[model samples]
Target chain A: MGSRLPTGWRDVQVAARAVRLVLTRPAYATAAVVAAWASLTVFVLSGNIAMVRNLVVSGPLSPGDRLVLVREQYPFLGTNYGTLEGVAVLAVAALAGANLALVAYHLREHELSASEGGGSLVGVVLGVVGAGCAACGSALLVGVASLLGVSGLLLRFPFGGLELSALAVLALVVSTYWIAHGLRGGEVGGCPVDVGGRR
Target chain B: MKQTSRSDRERTAGVDDGRPARRGGREPEGGSRSRRRLLLALGGVSTIAVAGCLGNGGGEADGDEDAGSEGGNEDGGGEGADGETLESHPVGVDLAEKPRLGPDPFDAPATLVVLDDPSCPRCAAYHQGTVAELRESHVAAGELSIVYRPYPVVYDWGERAAHALEATVERDPEAFWPLLGYYFDEQSSFTSDTVLERTASWLTAETDLDAAGIVADAREETFADRIETTLEAGSAAGAGGVTPVSYTFVDGVFQSPINGSASTTAIETALQL
Candidate 1:
């Protein structure tokens, strides 16, 4: 039977089961764990593969590429323009982590509509896995830059000396905050659930 | 009914109570109906995602045409348009075409083999900015031998399939740099078969090349096999297959370039420019 709910709150059940299916399944749960590793593997490989060549060839700068760069590249590099380009990529990774955390958060709150019991420990695990991906993706960006021997390019900026590995750790911390808070939400925030204790 | 278990009835009653809680209205059947709607919506989202991917393939084909046209216009409009340069420190005589090169421009030997689409504007800009510099300095000085693998992969001005690259190669490799410099400079002015052919004619006349013979040769698909071979080799070697791919033999080992014009510095640093 469908979850017991008042009208207009049906999505609560839908999102709850969605979270449950992902969290509770041993195989699906394991896949999430593997995905964390997989993304790391990809990051390592992409960095290594990118490093073999010494030349950075800006491809045919289509007029559009130039325009797009001119428009976004300014705000991107403004103030800290020289160093920000490197971290612009990391910022994107963090944003992705934040978005996934929000989805996990919504799923958790939605499940509460059904009952006090929502995502199990598996929700925490998957949330962490998503967070790991965000952190690792950013880390990989910096590592590849290093392996390519272009780390010196960042030297010109005032604070550009921050290592890519540090960027990765920063991403991980942000991802952890998002994943933990989103999954941990109100229950952990001290919202009293009927019986599920703190999420 | 299993002796009307207390827990089962409690569960059923919970749904029953939830219905009335919805604005104080009592629809005994509301809960079940709402569940069905939610399920239907979920199903619809999946169906749409699958259908969306298929639709995009067709959309990509259309996008390419628009992208090509838009790029050409943007490129042509920018030329000699001083506002766009990041540094006015450039636009010097070194930017123009020359019959020969001296010692200062490029010290080391560097030849760039670019697989380009004539109508693609990105390719045009790269041609104007980097490739032209190489031509004026390296090729003219006989320090580096440049090769043109005009990969007409994208739609060249909407007609004359493969007409663009083949014409450039067959027309005259010697004059290809100057011709390409001109073609890239004025991409927006010509986007059709007639315009392309007329431009080709003008290039031959301008360079005093054998224009009619080159155009006639291209029509026979003379450079067809060479184009295919080069594109295949490039793909095998991990090229993105987009316009403006450069396979540079820096010290005689072929390698791809890093992404961006700023690579100009990296390149100069690499080659001690």
Candidate 2:
């Protein structure tokens, strides 16, 4: 009963084990992949949703052409910002998928209220708002800023709004840990101490 | 001291087995309430932080909206007098040198000056959607004219495409629109290293233009100055930062600037059509 693990080590272990359990199931794995794909699409198309809609509605581009265009227009891919932005998009997508999967697992296993899944909702909303090209700005970010009465402040970000995406990734990671902690039979309201005498 | 597992303690404490321990179904309310409050505080703080990050602490204090609109008028120099109609605003770019679609500028009831980058996804969408719709509904009907100002804002490949566009405009003005269309159509296939070769080959196969000369001029950056001038003009017109921005002028009076992707309805309303 005297085992002293480092801070956050237990959370990480629990999260890893939970993720393994979730991914091993074919249904959960498929859900994760679908979620990841959807998240990636939203990130890539955040600012261009209207344009893409117009394209589909009245534009002359075929579906295949639209797909190609989207692939090439991924934020910072051909820009001077290097590949870090692309990596950020991928990381956000992956974390968002994992968060959703873990939340789903928690809900299935426990009879918790909807508030228990609030972290997952927060992570998703943050990811969508933060998804955009750091250099050119995403329409979602711009629209949100405009609503907040700060139309042009995104241009002043030193890292070109990458911080928003970073924050979103952090939120998703915490949400994942929270879900994992719950799945490991740890009380969410209490310190995640191992008391099962198993390890 | 006797050792008791967490599960055993929960059982002895009369916690419901079906309910999660965190829910505190029969436990004291303080811990659960505190945790919920903590999560709420964290969420509130994060929301505020996100808003702050995006808003950059300035909000409306910076007067960016007013300044941007003022700057746009000053840049375009197209501010019309009361009840006056002009052919076009003195946006500094030579309108005659640009590729045109539909009626002559003087003959059309409305003019749409488009600033776009070929490599821009939004621009591609605009080209495929609003542009195509307008070409059919307005341009072909002889009610509207479109002036293209290719301004590269996405990547270096866009600049190269601009050069090729200029070369095409120089040699065979009629081929300019198709070449621009081709670039938009196959945008993903061309990279900075491959745009020149691809454009040249496509031109040779698709049209009767001098593909080699166009490719050579693009490689030599023959139209760099022209492209830069158009870029400056677009910047001056307040469409610099974003691609696929359009300026609409109806009956020679500056109507509005459609930033980002211009929908057909917005353009139609601007055109008073």
Candidate 3:
């Protein structure tokens, strides 16, 4: 096995290749996949919120009122996706998710190139943070605060009374630009050619 | 420089052999190892992303379970406790008995009962105009006790919201009309899905009642029956077909059921003012 890989330009070249692949024909394909994933993520997360609301306000669903598991997965979309407005929102959210997927993809690739194996590490951190925020119980909080007339006081602080709407925007931003600068500067930390031809 | 030299030699070796590095071509062992490592890293990152999504899904499902259990816990009052026994008090009216609004066998000279739905826009308009006027002019003066029996005919959501209004009677009888007025004032926001949110918010903000407790109670089918009994009462009195129907009673005798949005003048005339 080849060892003692140099910390330099060949890695940059490989990253450039990845970026070129991303920006060229593969860019469309990557974005399309990411967008589809992002949209589904939004739907699932929102659906969970709706499910909780139903349970809280209506108690256990009788067999007659039980929602179809598969059909209920998309929450708002599943309920109103046939409507024009619902379709429009889903389309917009998917576009935002696509942008996010691009940023995440590039970030992971760059981290993998580093000697420290930080790519997977970064992914773990992101997964924890993203899951926490996406599933935050801000809806109930805000609803309570609005009722209490203290929303201004409670929700103003960071992560104190955070809302789902803010978390969603943050998800869109992180996904769109986490590795934006790295991609633009044409940097890649690791490359296959960095290994000398030793088997 | 050493790495460059190694790469250069490898390229030369390939060229000398009359082959060039090509896409999908067999890689030397070290390059293959590097490709494998790279794929592993990508795989790990993708796995994390997938796990994060799944985690959110799981979290929400868990929350639903918790909320369901919580709701069940508060429903200890059984499923059929009609809130009728809860004593209701209007401003300046103090009696040991539950003060029946509109019409009752309370030995009162006259009772003006308004059958309205929380979801009815016309009822909302009447409440804002006629009902408010009545509250200030007759109710405050003790000339008449205007009782609002929810007709619940506008829609299913309207019935549920009316149940929430009835829920307030059990906890805060003083807030009964105020809660109904709040529902009427924000009438557009009351949907089957949104009734709980709206009720909880208003109760939390405007009343000292436990918002969650109210939600837990209102979610019970028993609480819904409280509103159902009132509906039955309205139907028995021949005032269930259309909402905003006013029934005037003089000395415990039913006079007439005035349908549609009757003006304060028409209502007063029906009350024999």
Q: How would you order the candidates by DockQ, starting with the best?
A: 3, 2, 1
- In the range B114-197, model 2's lDDT, one tens digit per residue, is 878887765776788778999998899999999888877555688899999999999988898888889888877888999999
Question: Which tens-of-lDDT digit does each residue in B83-178 have in candidate 3?
Answer: 112122111122222224433334556566666777665577677876777767766666676766665655557777776766767777777877
Interface RMSD against the true structure, candidate 3: 18.4
Best by lDDT: 2
- Candidate lDDT scores, in order, read 0.36, 0.60, 0.44
Model 2 TM-score relative to the real fold? 0.53
Docking class of 2: incorrect
Clashes of each: 8, 3, 5
lDDT: worst 10-residue window of model 3 chain B: B70-79
Clashing pairs in 2: A47-A139, A59-B128, A59-B129
For model 3, chain A alone compared with the true chain A gives a TM-score of: 0.37
For candidate 1, list the clashing residue pairs, or say none: A55-B258, A56-B258, A57-B257, A57-B258, A57-B259, A58-B260, A62-B122, A77-A81
TM-score for all models, in order of appearance: 0.40, 0.53, 0.37
CAPRI-style grade of the A/B interface in model 1: incorrect
For candidate 3, the docking band is: incorrect
**Across residues B23-52, which tens digit of lDDT does each residue of candidate 1 receive?**
122322333343354345435643442232
Per-residue error at B191 for model 1, in Å?
3.8
Candidate 1 C-alpha error for residue B85, in Å: 37
> Chain A TM-scores, all candidates?
0.30, 0.78, 0.37
